[model samples]
Target: MRTGVPLRQESLVTPLRLPSLIGCALSLALAAGAAFAQTGTPALPPADEREPIRLLVGLPPGSGVDRISRVFAEALSQRLFRPVNVENRTGARGNVAGEELARSTPDGNTLGVVTATTMILNRHLSRQMGYDPQADLTPISRFASLPLLVLGGPGQGVRTIGELIEVLKARPSTCGTPGAGTAQHLALELLIRSVGARCDFVHFRGIAGALPELLDGGVQVYVEAAVIGLPLVREGRVRLLAVTSRVRSALLPETPTVAETVAGYEAETWLALMGPRGLADSVLVKLEAAAIAVARDAAVVRRLRALSAEPIGGTRTELAATIRAQDSIWGPVARAAGVTAD
Candidate 1:
């Protein structure tokens, strides 16, 4: 009787355990499927079958755009199992590179890392822009957004936005920008207009040329990408008065935002992946997938954060919407400010 009872119990438990094992396996398979759906599979050709990928950058090497482009290029090379190279095509406030990208073969081999200035502002500021951002380029994804830092040089005696305003009211001040129609210049113009302060803008060919002027008081204030200005601020060479973002930066929580001081003032630059118009849908899918993957990566997020940039990943539709929205906001502002590149 005891042996019969034990066999009956074993039979019942075995039946339940088999079902439990099967359920666990199914759950794991479903989880994997969900993950794959979110990230999407790599759609580009295998390394052996594909040509080397070129990432075209509009800014000089060591600029914020160039740095971010190289980071993404490295991450993409690993993820796509292909050799990725960064080509600096610096000129025309990023228009030279934009034209090159617009003329490239749309076979997934050429991609451009562009900013708001490259895609939206340049066209509004210059009539002779060689390529139409909306028509000549296909946005793959917007990968990051960088806030601008309003920095005061040594001997400026102004450590806060309020003090800067006071100084401007008392005497005219000059702000250094990287270029005439660049985002930095636009941001400075917006700030001046918002506060009704008196300031002149000095355009430099690049930030490297602008920094020395900033340090020596050739320029009283400089508005530049945080990635480029934060290091100098940290070294005690410059004072960070405010960031141009609507909110304070995570990397500089103690620093205030321009909007906090001057109502309705907010400006930030963004980076996007784009290809020449007429790119194959297949190529776009693969490039977008890789961009989204890199933008979502933990290491990439950490690196961008270190540079005071916010990582943003989204679809082509979303990127296009961003471009359109920025154009709508900045176009009128540029025209109002008489900001023409040529």
Candidate 2:
């Protein structure tokens, strides 16, 4: 989202400062980088000695996740004393990039910034996936948590979740999802199942492509990231029926959570950093420290807040546990709904 400097070689060493506390912590990251580099083979270059760290996103260039990841990547590179390069390896509902990351060397040089689909939903939806998310990846940290918004075009008669339910019950309505195995798709499926509402689902390559249908009334509803839906809602081009987060979104506090209507109904999309499985413990520790530092930076917090995202930084163990819990909770629901890879 920012285009300033071309990410100079010195900027990596130049501190990416936050307001106050963040600056102090990132100084520690610089110290750690120095210490970590020295403790290892001096012949082995500084973390900056390697080419830019490749941060892969499984989605295409213009996707919300891609845009957000690029912002963080740019910021983190400036903070972590290394160039951060973001690449889009798009295909297979993000399975292609997941597979590539899972297969990449575990040197902490190649990391993946992917959504919940690469780690959780894909596992539930397909058994023939090429890589094992848990077995083949090392969780670095999570930087953002995004809620899903239910959107409708004008004349849909769906001013509220209640009205949306009424409209769907009166006639079979169609909802569009970004991809077949995405949190957007599954969240809609969960809602339909919980409310016992019969509706059809339309799968688009991604949210940008799907929004057109909602704008034109080609689809009655869309479940997508708030970052994408907020602008439309603000423009009066679309109506936000509800947010799937249990709590009201900071971006649209006026909109109630779907959980308010259907208790126990909540879902969200998350973006996290992960590396190839078997990443060295030392390298993993350094990478995790860098990620934690980035997420806690005041500037990072401000940027994510603008997008209605909450920053979360934790140990790899915590991320793994989260993935496990999510998998357990959604597996049966996905199966019962007959969700599968497209």
Candidate 3:
């Protein structure tokens, strides 16, 4: 420790030694570059390119929407070669997340997964929506759809749509839905209007609270997503009479569509990928590819179907059309039902 030993032969910054030092540094850099080329390793990404992609979700973790959003996020993380994170920004039935997504920078790194409710019904029901869904958001893809089921527990008398409608028309009955202005609630209203039947509609915070009421015959019939309704049907807690989709659900192949009886009736809630408007077209195309890939992945399709959702993985145009279709259906139903967030 006491010895003053010289570490280098050249003076630290002599003009004569500087060129040699520079030459050595250049040689080393070139060598490193050549090694990287030979090894097929990518050069380090620029600072912005290394940033993680944030995938905002409009629901809480462990909820069906959040779980499905995570599945897409994982697949996208692999496809995009970036960390795609799922952040649960839950409130106002998804508006909280929608508004935030609309305000985020128009980079592919920031995107959102939202349901039909946020895109269509919320705009009609809530006066305080912070952003215009149509104007402020750029559609990417429609990934998953949940076909609702018209369910009745074994304790109820009816088993088919015809029988239920006949009973409902003959005598006023009580029906249940997840909430006042949900897709399930609108479907119920549409059914009532379509069939010229009357039922005192009961709304719950979620289907979980309403399930016990349905089983006990407190409510004659209930409308719920297949993800929640199918398990109850399999357990004999509820009977699946009809599906609310243009076609019958694959999970319940024999079941008739609501449209079969009430011609032109269909209401399916779907999840879509979107970014704030002004996102580059290149970014949208790249994201669309990842979405289509996930939709076509057999394993991913199986997992989504297991969760009672059908995989769509459709183009941005399909998502826009789906949103517009919901506007045609749910907006009218909500108005007829006298529903408003206020």
Candidate 4:
């Protein structure tokens, strides 16, 4: 049996508990090998294809997104019969890597995981961008939904949303988030505004950067992502006050939703597979198939859910619709918060 611990560089589906996915992929690989050995079949990886594909990540190495991308890339290499390499560009809240993907050759050789925040919300939040997200990229598929949380700092004793609100109303508090225009920032702002509480937001380049302040009481609360925050909560370093999803998280069923206290407040974010605009339909189709298959890999789903990221192996059409749908939700939030690129 596989370990159920998914994601490594070379082979993600193996050593993980995804029997069906591994069996199917191995069958396809074996069948392709046999086709070339016995009869006059077209074979699996076409004779003419040999170039490696590159996946651009907009975060530092070892970040959850980077690790997640490597998992998908390794699996895709198997399906496409090409080496898939992950490259980290890391800056501008993912815009740095996004620009690289936008400018890369679109002949299926280059693709990227553009955070949904960068694609949908940056249009309103960033005053200076190197490229237009919609015009510069082609949708492949959406693979994950990262849930956000309202985390209370140590010594606060603000264990619930109501207690947190009482403290917010009693005195000005500092709220921290990874970046200025991130879903966490907006969601944190929404919570304060909705509860009629007062707080000033402190923006850091990443959640790790703000951890010291939060633990020291310099920052009272933080909008943390479950991928990284769950470990902190489990370690007793921080308290999870509430989940920012519209509904309570399955991982913490007893935890209340921020919406339950304030109403209509959600700040969920996600990542999607994309290639530069003008990509050939054939290449897009191949990428889409590989991404969807890897996302639905039973092991990937289990590991992701454990981290509070719901796996969604949606199609290109679905991703495009999501792009269209998010403008209405986050645009107003960004405007109301008066957030802009820093």
Candidate 5:
């Protein structure tokens, strides 16, 4: 009887052990899968199996934004082993492009290059803007920043911010800007208000239109991107009094920043990648990685430097926070300055 009891107990224990081993294997497999996900190695579709990516640019071809977008598109294509194309959808101060991007499918195929003007200033200036930047888009990363240069023409007779302020207060100095609500215009307005100086803004259609006027002294001071102004400065057509970046630019280390003289003043235009809302975490991770890789690439860095723009790659959270902060700061300034596009 004891031998029979031992055999039955052994049979029961064997079945229980088989289930326990299977459960342990399943637990290990699950843990490994979780670990892989945590490492940003989530399973993505094969490059060949995915559709070509469309990089929506808000400016026309040959514009600064378009040029930067093409650089990033090439790098992203190489990284993802897929084709990427730039689509120019220019109109209504980038509202046309922003709306298109916002309305795109949340899938990773469609992305847009956004600027400080498009993401932060447009909404405050135009009530007809179709999309809300904070709600309609998911910021992927900020890839580059273009610093504005404070330029003085022949008649200005100012070589520094202090001299410029004194000139403005002494007489009626005219400042030329690309447009009413443009980054250049806003920066000039902010500077005037911050320093409590009297300066009038002359709105021009574009920088090309403003350049000749500036050279002829019709416009005493002109604030524009370094890329556009630096060539003239090099030729001695204009003088760079100060740069609007918080730190001295690498391209022009001899120049001082506006903050050095104004106590606290900085303004720059930035380029960032963003997608429609509801983007998957895996897709966001992949996009951000590709952007950062491009921003850090030696060749890409050189190209950006040539354009007088600096590579600044950071996480999505950082881009979102920048939009929020800039919106807060620029909104009230725009209102006070009576800057409106529409």
Candidate 6:
């Protein structure tokens, strides 16, 4: 026979209902206060929530774009009372990070540090990109511009654009690109078509991959952003034939402009910080201010110049207009060049 022990009331302890009630009430009140605080005003960051500001880049580590973004991150952290973090999400010629940024929340927390190639050229190249650079992304600020330089490999013994043109006329030489449909490729295309120069085109995975071929005398000339070309010029690994922009680069002051010889030649690449479109005015304003302040910093300017980049800070409207202008200008050029994304 089983004997059932009498159950004691005290044995079954009840939870502290009063404390739970109090906690729930407190949580509701705090949430209500936050909601009320944000009701009429822009969703300003909570005063106590010092979350990290993520600046996403589309280039690999140690790249000029990455370096400039990191430098701005340090400067922005000082300007904003929060930590600034840079994340590299490289692929699709920078369209990967551009797409990510375009689809991200427009809360001013996530930003894309992008170049004109991603903004202007990739659209012309790629047929099925996930997002539209001009439509999905809001350009908050233009940070910098990098001019491209036309350089000659050892085979030509060419010291100037004129000499290089002469050599190309004498014999067919090939120019190298980081890849097809890149800004570098477009520059070479324009150069070749403009002057009717005879040259074959070679595509590499990146400037680094193509650089070895240049050094081995496999490619005679390459048009690359000064950030990539300046180092080789300094090391005597390559000779700068000419820069594309009208004015000479501060980093390579001695290198003359191809524009001087081939008038109307310019392929200056730009870098900017942008966020998802429809970002609230308040958040957009703060981000724009932060970016402009960082670009205006003397230290930032010096560091950017060291990378052969020029710092340029402008309003959202200004950046948007620039994007539109570039789209108009390069869209036709890209089509004419028969550039397609790989």
**TM-score for each prediction?**
0.78, 0.78, 0.85, 0.79, 0.85, 0.80
lDDT of 6 by residue, 216-267 (tens): 7888888888887778778887787888776887766787887888888777
Of candidate 1, the 10-residue stretch with the lowest lDDT total is: 5-14
Off by over 4 Å in 1: 1-49, 169-171, 204-219
What lDDT does candidate 4 reach at residue 309? Answer: 78
Candidate 6 versus truth, CA RMSD in Å, comes to 10.4
| Most lDDT-accurate candidate | 3
lDDT of 4 at 52: 84
lDDT (C-alpha) at residue 274 in model 5: 94
The deviation in Å at residue 3 for candidate 2 is 85
Each model's lDDT: 0.85, 0.82, 0.88, 0.84, 0.87, 0.84
lDDT of each residue in 106-128, candidate 5, tens digit only: 99889999889999989889988
lDDT of 1 by residue, 1-342 (tens): 445544343444444578898999999999888887999874556655467888999999997678888888899888777888999998888899899999998788888998898888888888998779789999999998998998887776788988887877677888888877778888888887777778887888766787778778879888888888888888888888999988888788999998898887789999999999999887788889989999999999998887678888888999998888878888887987787887
Pitting candidate 1 against candidate 5, the one with the higher TM-score is 5
lDDT of 1: 0.85
Clashing pairs in 4: 4-17
Candidate 2 lDDT tens digits, 151-214: 8886666688978877777788898887666678888888888888888888988667876787
lDDT of 3 by residue, 96-141 (tens): 9999999999978889998899988898898988898888999999
In model 2, pairs of residues that clash are none
Q: What local lDDT score does residue 184 receive in model 1, on the 0 to 100 scale?
A: 87
Per-candidate count of clashing residue pairs (backbone under 3 Å): 0, 0, 0, 1, 0, 0
Model 3 misplacement above 4 A: 1-47
Tell me the tens digit of each residue's lDDT in model 4 across 1-342. 767876666964555468877998999999888977888555467755658888899999988888777777887787778899999998988899889999998788888988977798888888899899988999999998888878877776678988888989889989898877778888887788788888888988877788888788889889888988889988988888998887877677988988898867777888899999999988889889988998899887777776567778999999999888777877887998887875
